[model samples]
Target chain A: MITVNNLTKKYSGTTVLNIDSLEIPKGQSFGLVGNNGAGKTTFFSLLLDLIRPTTGAIENNQIKVSESEAWKPYTAAFIDESFLIGYLTPEEYFYFIGELRGQNKADVDSFLAPFEDFFNGEILGGKKYLRDLSKGNQKKAGIVASFIGNPEVIILDEPFANLDPTTQIRLKRLIKELADGNDVTILISSHDLMHVTEVCERVVVLDKGEMVKDIQTSTETLQELETYFTR
Target chain B: MLKQFISLQWKSFFRSASLSSNLFFKILTIFFALYLIAMFTLLGGGIYFILEEKVQKDPLLIINQFLIFYLFIDLVFKYMMQKMPVVNIKPLLYLPFSKSKIVHFSLWKTILSFFNFIHYFFFIPFAVVLIIEGYPPGHVIGWTMGALALIYCNNFINVFLNDVDAVFYSFLGALVILFGLHYYQIFDVTVYTAPIFDALFNQPYLVIIPILLMISMYILAFRYFKNILYLDGGLQQKQQEAKTESFDWLNRFGGISVFLKNDLKLIKRNKRSRTAVIMSLVFIFYGMLFFTGAVEAYEGPVWRIFAGLFVTGGFLFTFGQYVPSWDSSYYQLMMSQNIMYRDYLNAKWWLIVIATILTTLVASFYAYFGLEVYLAILVAAIYNVGVNSHMVLWGGAYVKTPIDLTSNKKAFGDKQAFNVKTLLLTIPKLLLPMALYAVGHYTIGPMLGYALVTLAGLLGFAFKEKVFDIIEKVYKTEKYKTIAAYKQKN
Candidate 1:
């Protein structure tokens, strides 16, 4: 669980993200939606404490995100490509993530087993490194590795942008399954309204650094998103 | 369309110029230009003076040998220049220009590099001196042109070979074979160059090989345009192998395992950074060679210890200077994660310790080689732990150069911007250790003096965490300054 209160961030005198209060319960899928420069990414970054907030605080699993030692073992995030070590192969990358999380090596291999067909030995247990793989494959590898150790909270920024349609649906299904079965709270921010509606139980619409709407996906129709997007 | 492409190239080049002209670039330009001129002056003046009187008798042999040597040196420079990160220019590919023009421009830009100065600084001066001393003007011009052409050819050839990965190794292989042949006198290149030299000094037709080689280099460089056109080759695809280090070596120490991994990675991947490791070892070798003579010359164990420490640890401080820059791109991610600044700083400390330990081992080998250098190594190691490590740690913590580790440029920060503070710190941190050693030789003698160093180092180790915290506080407070130091366009 995560709670952000009275959070504000500024860069060069311009407010980039401002939040009064927000909470993400355990075992739920939360979608963050915004147009370009809408502070969605900034909000995610704040929750992870990547950058210090101008004011206010965040608590993840009861530990203050900025001040305490929590969120390390219980949370994982892929803010951008910097999160991925480009030199390591997919298998090696996952193993690295596994080791960092204190998971056994076999656990990593078992987790990767289902994706073997998609990976085709191209991404894992192969001569090819992550740097050599195509962009889609690299993204898939990064996504899979981010989920290593089954953290209580997983935050992914623009998780489906570069993926092919088939992989997109597959990943969506995978995310839903993880949120439903493993009791993992997942926060995925993307512009794809259809994708968000399909997987996320609730969606937060942000515009110009402020949260404009927080609505249950079950109640709000797809057409309602057009208003937030246009504004 | 071609006109549009050329315009685009021009704009891009000028944009790059703006970026490069940052304060860092200006300092680098001044330093590099001065250093280059100074080095060439020393080397060129020495060779020219040595050969000036002899060239009147047999100038061709001398000129030819010089040309070959120039070509050899120029070839190494060419390889380094070609490897510089023009790969980032891929963003320009989406612009309206054909890839062919971009490659052509890149080849043309190579001539602008500083390596072309072997002709201007060394050969032209030799030619001028020869002409002034009564060699015919035509012969002098021919020789100068030939020498310049030969250097250009070598530069182009190296650039060409670098495009295909096979070229560098093949060039190395050919060099080895040539060295073997020359030593055995089976085929004497010096003898071969005699006629060309004679033609240049006595006659003027011998300039043809250099002329032809120059033309061939242009052709080869043009051919490389095709290779650059299709940038996807096995060269770029060379992947990093997964590290399978047995941390049993470092893990026993506890909390140092991650640092061990990072240290190993830095050596394995960063070619320029690997130099720090090799340089430390080379100094150790030099310490062994110079120890006896140095002792005889100075007649003091203190002098020996001072010399050993400086020689062995010359490259020490440069190790941690790029700490933030090395991880700048991912720092946002790492910062976001559960990683504490303290743990991050501790990891860096461990890397320094590992490097220092490795240097000490090399120093130990110097002891085995009959110099009693192990005592000096012990002293140096202690100084390294007690003083040098903190010096570097603080220096690195304060350094702001956000180095791109993937680039061919050494350290990836500013090439020419050495801070006065960094320079000032070196005097005391490095020289004081030697000064202390020197004082000890008179006051206490070698054994006691060396023991003093060892004890101080051990004590420093005991209180290292406290020292690190103090450094960390300074680092945090000066983080913005540090960022500016790294980011200032050097």
Candidate 2:
């Protein structure tokens, strides 16, 4: 339920991302993949309106993100450590975000109950702030907090990068469960081809901000992605 | 609820990384806060009697006559000492909460600043005095409220000015011109502003005039913040074309040059260090406060030496004490390198020396205070570069607090890379120099005083090799400890 039209972002005359047109239907699981300078983060940032677009607009649901802030209620994103306030405890952060989304502390506590196993009992009931947590635990907290407020759209950038192996596996299961016949729109960018392919039904490959491939995942999709990378 | 924002802010402040790290610092900060409140109360309470004794006129009329001047200076002090509450807005930007509410929350929190409360500490006591002195209670209350409204109006104006540099500069330029006109008797602004405050005291209800102005300024700041609340929105981002500049001129100095260049870059790029450098430079003119005054208390030898030491050595004391901790972000990388410890220490030493020299040279106008004062400044500068600079570096070994170069929380002392031990250590450093000067002046005359201080500096310079060796050993032992502290990011 996102439409990007004539989107281009340039830095000092160097065009980093120049998407002509792209659209994701409601309830779609979308994955983006690109190498370091391929503008995967840039595109996600533009979608989140974290940075202004050089030209054109992004429509979330039916409202233009730049023109109005109405779409913010249904949208949530965990782009990086900057998305987490460093001073707040994990539970406090969750409650803060939940409060912003019209949920009380009880609602947030209930929302967090299902992620106890995912947190491995390390994040909650702890005196340490989110900033003091290990990178993997920090990522877990950020990812779980995005799930609060029952958001319709969630954006995560490099979500699988710093996670430990067990957490990564659990996250994959979590994503698959959320996307299974769910109306939630999940958009994630990752360098891990296998995880993205398994979790996301449709994967888009970008090269230097240009959309190079949009493939529907299948039995052969893994081999095709491998070939594309090796080539 | 709107109250959640305040509670979250409270959590952010008390749970701040540094505040929780040391119990001593927390107590000291609270003590300092209470001390300031007590001082303000005394000043505000005493003003009524002081005015009564100085000029047989009514204190209210006297205050009203200078109210505009007071507000103008208050505006400058407010801008310098106060900061809008810093909220990490990225996480909050996309939340469902309205942008205006976030702006309003920040504005509401700004009212909690120590600067704002300090006004109440001043005004409330003075208002009590006014009522006790048989002034109409209603009129005194109205005058106090009116004055407070204008104070808050100044706060909002300062906020708006702080946001945009062009606006701030123009605002300052206008104020300077107005002040200059009054200073030279070219204009009498007191003739106009005195009546505005007079009306507030007379009618009691005319406080509404400033109340309206306060609301307008509040709305002005609110609209400005609301407009910029969108992520990546504010002013148009200017992305300059990237080009690498070479420091080849520094290449001739060998490995020391490399360290020097890095230190320079650290000061240039980091927010906290850069601000320190600017403040140290600004402090060089501190002599203006002590030397230019006509008051006899300021003419004492103690004040002269204190001001002289500050005029020359301020940079060495402030910036030198944090040399090692300034590189806290990359202390591990530095220790891991094959670079000699002497080079690291010498590079920092040289930077401090150069900074002291630069500050002293820029402040040479202190010569106008006469040759005696100029000689004291020269002696102090030499003492600074020699003895004080080395002491500061030695003090750095004891300072294990890691500064967050990225987040400039407040301008002074909050993230300063020194602990209470070194802070206490500075008292001896300050007093020893002053005592030496005072001893020489009182016992043997000013020339002997200069010679004594200058000789002490030369003595320190003569054996710097020993000093550097001792400091290097201290730093070597503390390097890993410092790295661990720096790794714990705030």
Candidate 3:
């Protein structure tokens, strides 16, 4: 389980992310939704310890994320292109990430074998560096590389944003597979409420750095999210 | 259309993200430029008098004999240093302007480069001296104009030189062969320059040849750029074939070697880091320039050791300074990974130490300079691997600005403007070694000097674990700041 307790991040005395308490149980598919300044990324940054929180602690599986590196082994995230090495081929990048996670090249190769459909014949065995790839292809590389070591927690921010419709559907299925079959805890942040609702077991709405609603996903969840946003 | 393009470029320059930080350096650069202009002017004005006292022949004929050599050196220097300043044509390509006009404007822009003006800095003063010496103004005009046409021709030729690596190598190889043939007294390669330049003064119309040559080069450059001006052509970087190599052998060393292999790939794959690697190679031969001169020219162990330090520690100076920033493109990925700071820093230190050792081995041939010279280099290399490498990595922890690997196209890519902090950090790295060696050399003895350097290095090697702890602490404390800085748009 991940516990975010009294986490608040301020930029020049202006609070950006303020959360009193939030619990994300292991092996659950959780979704985060918000507008541009609603602090979705700020919250994620604090969770990853990429930025320091003004006042609070985040614990990942009983280990404080900032105080120790123990969480990094069991946690994986793909926040943006900053997470990808631009100069490496997708395969090299995969092998690099695999090696970091204590997986051998053969292990990475096998893990990536089924991802060909998701790669759409463009990523692996190709000469193009990640930077040269189209944005959707680069995201595919980043997202799939996050899955290499089979980390218990996977965090993906806006995974379906730039993707083509076909690839978007493929990614949704991939997320569902990890959430259900592999017993992985998945945290997804997306502006596309329809996609997030389809994949997440529970979805939370963040309004200007505060949680406004936390609801269980059901058949009418997409409509509920759409109605909230439209209003 | 040209005015609009110029205005757009001006706005981009002032509005650049780096402009605020680079403003101080810009002012410094202006003073540096003034110094060069002054030096060139002095050289031009004094050339006649200097030659009159030294050479038996007429100064004009003697200098004319060397004009081709001067032009060759000028062209090569410009090839190394000059960049076409502000004609990024990609955005302008889709505009209403004709493609040829854009190409023409780009070509015309090079004519205004400070490089072309340097010829006047030297030649106009030389012309004044000629006129003062009673040479006809008409002849001087023809000669100077012809000389400028050739220089501009070189400027245009540099455009083609950028695209053809083979041609560049051939130019270098050809220079070596020509210099070799001259060295052996087999031929005088500069035999033709005197006549061509003399003909410019005698038959003023002969200037037409150089003018024609300049026009042809301009046309060639314009046509080449125009051909590739299409949106999907040369302006768009072609996807390169991913060169894959199995680093399976490095798996034995575990995490450290993984970073080592990845860093090796970083240097191999990125344009900026690769330039740093090649520059280190160029500095390896820097010893030859001083070593080939008479022994008395640099008699002391100090100068010999100085050159040796450069010979052996070249890669350390060149590539070590930009340690973590070379990975700035993917630094967040590294920081967020499960990799330990100890492993990452140790891997970098090892890579540079290995490079120093390799360069030292290459310079062992400098034993031809004598065991004394080579031993000085060996001692310095040992010191470099042990001490200087750690110092550089320490400095790297503070590099707040990130290097944009793909976009840094400066010929001196190591000096490419990003951080003054990096430039400042290089000082202690350079001075500490020299100061340590010099202090021991001056007070105690040469043996103690070598021993001091060697001891310093050994101590650094011994305490590296302690050093790494400090470095790691700095990394942890600065983590959020580095992440935020690296995320800034280049």
Among these predictions, the greatest DockQ belongs to 3
Reference-based lDDT, each prediction: 0.66, 0.77, 0.81
Per-residue lDDT for B22-134 in model 3, tens only?
A: 56656765666787789889988889888988885678887787888788878766766675554566667677989888777777877887878878989999989988988
Query: What is the C-alpha lDDT profile of model 2 across B1-490, one tens digit per residue?
Result: 5777767787887876567555675687677778879988998899999889989898889899988988987886676556557565556767787778878877877777777778898899999999999999999999999999999998887776655546755765777688768867999788898988888899999988889999999999888877765445552232222222335576577657666765665676554576577667757877776777745567777667677778887667667877787766545434422346898888888888888888888888889988988887888888887788888888777766776764433211122322233345467677877888889889979888888889998999998999999998886666545655666665
- The complex in candidate 2 yields a DockQ of 0.02
- Report the lDDT tens digits of candidate 2 across residue range A1-231: 999999999989999998889999998889999899999988887776556789989999988876655777778888777676554567766765675566766898788998888999888887676656789998999898777787889898999999989999999999888888569999999999999999998999999989999998888888899999996
User: What's the residue-level lDDT of B305 in candidate 1?
Assistant: 67
> Model 2 in CAPRI terms: which quality?
incorrect
- TM-score per model (chain B): 0.71, 0.86, 0.86
Shift in Å, residue A83, candidate 2: 22
Those runs of model 3 whose alpha carbons end farther than 4 Å from true positions after fitting are A5-21, A53-59, A62-67, A181-183, A207-212, B22-31, B86-88, B112-120, B124-138, B201-208, B294-301, B406-428, B435-449
User: Could you give the CAPRI-style class of model 3?
Assistant: medium
Which residue pairs collide, candidate 1? Answer: B24-B489, B24-B490, B25-B490, B60-B197, B400-B482, B400-B486, B401-B486
Q: Write the per-residue lDDT of candidate 1 for residues B411-454, one digit (tens) a residue.
A: 11112222223344466665666666656667877666676676
lDDT of 3 by residue, A5-54 (tens): 99998899888888999999989999999999999988888888898999
